[model samples]
Target: MNAQEILDECAALYTLPGPPKDFGERTVSDRFEPAAVPTLITNATIWTGNNNGTEVIHGGEIFLEGGLIKYVGDRVPSHFTTNNRVRSINAQLAWVTPAIVDMHSHLGVDSAPNLAGSADTNSMKALIQPWLRSLDGIDTHDESYPLSISGGIATALILPGSADAIGGQAFIIKLRDTKDRTPLSRVLEPPYSLLNGTRVDPTIPPRWRHMKHATGENPSTWYQGTRYNEARKLKLEQDAYCAKAQAHQWTGLPAQIPKNLKWEALVDVLRGRVKVNCHIYETTDFTSMVGLTNEFEFSIAAFHHAHEAYLVPETIKKVWGGVTPGVAVFATNARYKREAYRGTEFAPKILHEHGIPIAVKSDHSILDSRFLLISSKFAALRKALKGGLQGEIGQWYKAVAEGKIPLVVDVAKADHIATLLELKAEVDEYTGKSLRLTLTHATEAHLLAKQIAAAGPDVGVVLRPARQYPTVWDQKRVLPGPPLSAQSSVGVLTDANVTVAIGIEEGWQARNTRFDLAWAALEANGTLSRTEALAMGSSNLETLLGLEPQTDLVAYRGGDVFDLSSRVAAIISPARGFVDLI
Candidate 1:
C-alpha cells in the first residue's frame, strides 16, 4: 500500500487498536492454535521457567494435546498413556522444556543480509509516527526465519528500527517459516506497542524531517526543535501531546470529533492497554521518562537498552504514578556510545534491588542474537559479585547494630571514617572495584545494601531473546578494563531470585541463531551453573515471555544437549508435526 493510503486507512481505524477480533476489545490474549494430538512423554527432566525460584522435575512426565500442555510433573495420569492414538515416548535421558521466545527483534522488517531495498526499519518521515506498523512492512522470505526456528526460537516481538524518536508500532510473531510468503499466517499479534522513540534527534535538519505521508505539511515541523530549547523543550511539547491524547478518549457520541491515529495511540499507552517499549539509556532519560509517564498516568513496558540503569535505583523505586518499566539492558556490552558507556553489568542486580524487573535484549546484530543467554549469564555474574560486596557491608553493619562499634554521633570521627574505609576497602577488594562511597550516601550504598540484601530479592526478570550484540569500544567501554571480567561473571543473580527470559532484538541480523547463544551461555564460564544456563536459553525465556502453560516441547540428545551446533533432537508439537533440530 502507498504511504498516503496507509495513513488514510489507519486514520479510519477509529475504533482503536484492540485484541483479536473474536475476543472483542478486551486485552492481548494468546490466539495460537494448540497441537492437535494427545501425547505422553515419560521420565523427562522438565524446566519450568521461573528462575527466581526453580521448579525442575528430575524425572518428570507430561501430557500435551491440542497445542497446550495439559499436565507436567513427576508423573503423568495413567489414562493418558492408555489411549491407543496417544503416542508415548520414554524421554528419561532427555530434557523437555518450552520453546525460546525472542522479546525484541527486527526479523521480517529489516529482512536478512541487510540490503538497502529491504531496509524498512523506520517511518522516518516524522519523529512521532505511531500509526506506522512494523506489521505492514515485514518480509517473511527473510532467511532469518528457518535458521532462528531451528535454533529453538518459536515466538518474537518484531519491531521497527530506532531512527526517528517515535518510530512505529511493534508486532509479535511466531517463528514458523513458510518460505517467507503470506504475512497473516505468521503473525501472532500486531500493535504489540505503539513505539515511542525518546530523545528525538535535532541533529536531523528540519528540511529533511517534515511529515511526508499526509498532505498540507508545507510549513510546520512535526517537532519544533529550536536551538536553545531543544531537548527539554521538545520533551515538554511531547508531554502536552500525551496529555491531549489521554484526554481525547472516545465515547462514540456523534458530537465527538474522531481522534486521529497519533492521539489514539498515545491514549492506548495512557490507558495502559498498550505498552510503550521505549528506546532509552542515560540516567537523565530514565528520570525524565518516569516523570513524563507519571504525568500522563501511563507505564513503560520496558526501557530498551537501559545501559545506565544502575545509576538510578532509588529513582526507579519511587514508582511515581504507575508501574515503572523494566530495564531492558545490553548483556555484557558497554562503552560504545557516550550515553551507553556508564552503567555496570550489575545494573540488573541494582535495578532488581530497587523493585524493577529486568529484561535483557540482544539489540540484534549489535550484540548478536545468539548472545541473549550469554548476556544474562553476565548479569548473573555481576549480581554474584555485588552480593559479595553486600556480604561485606552486612558483616560491618551487624557489628555496628550490635553496638560492637561505638555509635559516634557527632563531629568528624577519624576512627569511624577510617573504620568504614577499612570495611569498604575489603568490599572493593573482594568485589574487585572502587566504589565512591561517602557518609552522605543512602543506606543502600552504605547500610541499606546490607538491609535489602538481607531482606530478599527486589524484582524477578523477564526473558527476552535479543541483546545489544557484543562490542568493545575504547571511550564508551565501562570501567574495570578486562573484557573477561565483564563477560565471565555468569553465576547466580542472588540464589533463587531475579528472573530471565529471551528477547530477540535483532533476529534477522543474527539469522535467528538462538541455540548458539544458548551454547555460549552454558559454556561462558564457571559462574553459570549448567541448569541455570540451560534455563536461560530455554524455559526461563518461555516463562518470561508469558508463553507458559504450553505443551510444546523441544527434545535433545547428547549429555550436552544445549550445545549450539547440534543439541537439538526434535521439536514436538501436539498438533504440529515433529521438526528436526539438527
Candidate 2:
C-alpha cells in the first residue's frame, strides 16, 4: 500500500531467479549437522561413478569433516592425523562411491504400507493446480526412509503425482532425518523468500523452483478434456494480470500489485522462474508439449515417464530456449497401461544416441526408490543387447527345437506349469524337440523344476522380487525362503540343473535386490559364486534394462556390496558435499 512496499513488489517481479551469489563459495553445507564428527575412511575399493562408471580405485582414502568431503584420494592430508576429534575407519577393501540420487520419486508424499490416509499424491478437484505443493503432504515418519537409505539412497526429488495437467510443485529432499524432525528441515535449497514475511532482497538472486506438468492420458483421462485449450486460457489470463501490474494500473484504491493465488505459479513459468517437469508418453503428447513450451515461451526441465521420447528427439530439441529436456524413464517397466504400450527397453540407448540426456527413474511406490540404481543397471544392459537377440520365425522355430533359443514364459501359478508344458509340447510337435525354455515369476516353478530342466539345456527360471509373497491368488503357493523353508525356489530349481536369476517385483523390493541375490546364492549352497551373485543384482540387471551409467556412489564394508556379510558403512556424496556415516 505504501510507496516503499509498491516499489519492493515491482523490483521482486523483474528480478531474475537463481542460486545466491555466494552458493558455490560456501565451505560448510546448509544442512551440516552440528553433532556430526569428522571421519576418515581408508583402504577401500571405490567405484567412483566416473569414466562412464568404469573408473575404479583399488585403495583409496576419503576424509569427512565440517559436513563436507574434505579430501578423497590415495592418501589423507597430514593435518587430519593431528586432529584428536577425527574418527578413523578401515573399509577393509570394501566398495565406495557417491550416494545415489533418485531422479524421480514420491517417497514421503505417498508413504508405505498403503494405509487409508497415507497417500497425498494427487488431487482431482481441478484439472490445473500449479500452486499446490508436495511439501504440505510429506509424512516424515514414512517407513521407506530408513529402508531406502539402507539401500544407499541419500537424496530424492519428491514429485507430485500426474493426476492432472498441472498437478503441483515438487520439492527435492535429503533422506536423512534432521534433529528438527520437520519436513522443511529435509528440504534441499528451498527458495529464500518462501517462508519469510519480509520483502525479498533485490540484491540476491532467487533459488530455482520446480513445478510438475503432464500430458496425454493422465491429464485427459482425469479431466475429460484436452489440457492445451485450458492451459492457453490460463496463460492469457496470467499475461493480462502481469501486464496490468507492470503498467501500474489501479483497478482498486490501494494500487497494490495484482495477485491470483491459483495463477501465480503458472505465471512464474512464463517468466522462466520455474523448472517444469512434464509427464508425457507417445509421440503425439511430446509434440503437443513441445509446441506448448514454444508458444508459452518457457523451457521444460525434463520429461518423466516419456516412453516414446526416443522416437521424437528432434521434437524435444525444439523446446523453447534451445535446451533439450532430459528424458527420465523406467528400464523394463512398461505396457501395463495404454499410454506405455509402445515403450521399449532400448529407449535409453536410442535417446542417448540422439544426444538426449537420459536418466532411469523409479516412479516410487510404482517402482521403489531404494532399488533406483538397479533400474540404471537394467538400462545399461538393455543398451548393450540393443533390443535383444531375435531371429526369423522359421529360424526361431529351429533354434527352439535345437535348444539354442530360449522361450521365456511368465507363469505365476502352479497350474500355469501345465500351460507351459502344453506350449512346450506344441513347440515339439511343430518342430522336432522343444529344448530351450525359461520361466519368469515362476512362483511355483520349483515344484516342477525336474520336468522343466529335463525339457532342455537352456531351460531356466527367474524369481522376480527374489522373494515370494502370496500377494495374488495365482502366487498363493509361494515358496517362502529362509526361516519358513530350508531351501528357496532358487535352490530347488538350481539343484535340478535349471539355471536361476533373481529379480524384483515392486519398487520397495528393488532396494532389497542385493539381499535377494545374496540369499539366492546362499541357498544355492556353493553353486553360485560371490561374483555371480553380484552380477545377478548389478550387471545382469543393467543388461536387462538398458540404463546409462551413473556418477553417484555408495560405500560398503567387510565385503562386496552384494555380499550378505557386507554392510553399508558410509555414503561418499560429492553432490551433497558430505560423507554420511551409517
Candidate 3:
C-alpha cells in the first residue's frame, strides 16, 4: 500500500452508498438513570473545590441528593436530614474532598493484562486519523476501573494511544455502570475534542528503523518511507483541506468541501470546535507548531509530555512579529526519550512563571492509574527546588555518545551525528548537575524551600511516582519504586502552593504508585503539607481539568495532618450514587 491508498481509505470516511437519514429527536434510546437515594453526612471537614481551600467547611455536613450536592455546611438541611428517603452517616472526623479525576488515561481502551487483542489505543495504519475514538474501543470490564475507584478516582478522560503523528479522538467518561452495560450511555461527554498524538523521538519502535517497515499503508509496504516524509505530507494535506474548509466557513462558497468527515474534524479544530492534544517534547515542536497553528487557525488544547516547554519563551517574536501559544501542558516524566533530553521537572515552574498552566500526567500504563495523584506531587516538588545546574541541549548528544547514559547501546554507533561540541566542565563532567541528568535519566530541579516558596503558585505541576517506568526498555516491564531522600523535589512543589493534579500514566500498571508517591511526600520532613497531598488526589485534579460543581467526594481521616494514608475509603459519585468500592 502507498500514500494514495491511505488517502483513499480516508476518503471513504466521508461517503456511503445511501443518502443520510435524519431521525430527529423523538424518544430517547436507553437513556441513563442515575441512582435516586439521597445521602446525608454530618461532622467532617470538607473542601469545596474553591482554589487553595479558601472555602473549606469545618465540621461540615453535606446533603447529597439526586446525584448532586444539595447542601454543604456545618449543618445538614433540616428537610434532607428529616426526610425518611434520605440516608445519613456520622462522618468519622474525616476530610471530605472531591473525587479524583485522572485526566490522562487509557483505561478501557488499552485494557490491561498486556494482551494484543485488548490493546486498541493506537492505529498504526494511518499517520493521521482524527476519526478514531476511544469510545468504540472501550471495554467496560477493564479491572483498572474498579482498582482506580478504590483509590477514590471517580472520573477519567480515556484517550487514544499516541502511535501516529495524529492518533485519534479522546472521550471523557464516568467510571461507573449498572450490572448491564448501557448502549452508548456510559459516555459522559462523547467526542472530548482531543486528537492525541506524540512527537517524542525515542518512543518510535525499533522495527520501524528500516524503510521497508515504516510505511503507513499497511505494515508490510516496502516503498521508500520515513516518518519525516509522512509528517510533511500530512501537514500539506491537512492544510489543503482545512484551508478550503475555512474558505467555506468564511465565504460560504463551494458548498463546504464535499462533507469529508476526516477533513470535517480538522475543520472543527480550525473553527474552534475541538482542540489537539499531542504528546509533545522539546522546544522545536513547540515553536514550530505555534507557527503551524497560526497558519491553520487551530489552537492546541494541551501539549502532553511537554518536557522542554519551559525553554519556549512565553512571548516569542517570530518572523511575523509575536506568538502567544495560550496552551496548557500535561507535563509528564521527562528526560527519558531522545527529543526530550533537555526535559526538566522544573518545566512547570518556568512555564508557570511564563503564564502557562501545567497538569501532571501518568501517561497511564507508563506510571499506572493508581499513582496518578503522586505524579502531580512529584512534578510540583521537583520543579520547586531552589537552585540547580541546568543541562545544555546543544551538548547533550555528545555526552550521550561518549557513554554518559544508558540510552545508547554502543558508543560506536554515531553515523547520524558527526563531530561534537565541547561543554563546560561543570555541567558536562557531571559535577554541577546530578548524574541523573544524563541522556537516559532525568534532570534535577534543585532549589531551597524559601526559593520554591517564592516561585509561588505561578508554577502548577502534575507529577507521578519518581523513576517508576514499567513496560519500558524494549517492552520489558520494569517495576520497582526508587528510594526517597530529604532533598526530594515533591516536597518543594507544595511549598510554592502550585495548583497540582495527578494522572495514571500507565493505567493498571501503576495503580499502586499514587499511594507510594503520597507516602514519600508525607515522610519527607516539612515539605508537602497534608492538605496539599490529599487535594491532589481530589479537588486539585478536578480543578486542573476544569471539572465542575465540586460534588462527588471522598472521605478520609481529618486533623492537623490529613493524608491518603486512610486504610479505609468512602466515596460519593455522580454515577453508582454513594457506594464505597474499596
Best by TM-score: 2
Candidate 1 C-alpha lDDT tens digits along 1-582:
133333332333223344334444332234434433477888898886667547777888888765557678778777656767798889853667677777677787777878887878776586657667777788877877777775567877776776655566676778774443577557664332222332122222111010111101221222231111232343354444434444553233233223544454554444344556766666766676566556555556666777776887667655445466566777567767676668577788888877888876655545445444533443333333345235676565444333233222111222233344444444456545443222221111211223323322311232222232223221122121124444321222323343433344355734444554454364344555657665755666444333454466777676355454446667777646655565
Candidate 3, superposed: residue stretches over 4 Å from native:
1-33, 179-183, 191-257, 313-332, 372-582
The per-prediction tally of clashing pairs is 49, 19, 33
Tell me, by lDDT, which candidate is best: 2
lDDT of 3 by residue, 381-455 (tens): 232221222457424533432334312111111111011111222223443332211111111222222432343
Once fitted onto the true fold, the runs of candidate 2 whose alpha carbons sit more than 4 angstroms away are: 1-5, 80-82, 198-200, 221-254, 372-582
Question: Considering TM-score, which of the candidate structures 1 and 3 is the better prediction for this target?
Answer: 1
Worst 10 residues of 2 by lDDT: 379-388
Put down candidate 2 lDDT per residue, 1-582, tens digits, no spaces.
465556566667667787777877777888999999888999988887778989888889988887888777889978866788889999987778788888888998889877769789998888878879998999998999998887678988889999888889999999999999999889888877665845457667666789998888777752333344445566575456556555766465345555666777776787778889989998987877787777668899999999888888899999998888899999878888998988887899999999999988778878777764433443333322232244665555455455565655676766667556655665566556545566778888888888877766545667776877777656768777666887778778767876667776667777778777877787766776787777666655443333343334678888877666888888876756877889
Candidates arranged by TM-score, highest first: 2, 1, 3
The CA root-mean-square deviation of candidate 2, after full C-alpha superposition on the true structure, stands at: 20.9
Instruction: Flag the better candidate by lDDT, 1 or 3.
Output: 1
Global CA lDDT computed for model 2: 0.76
Scored by lDDT, model 3 comes in at 0.50
lDDT at 457 for candidate 2? 55
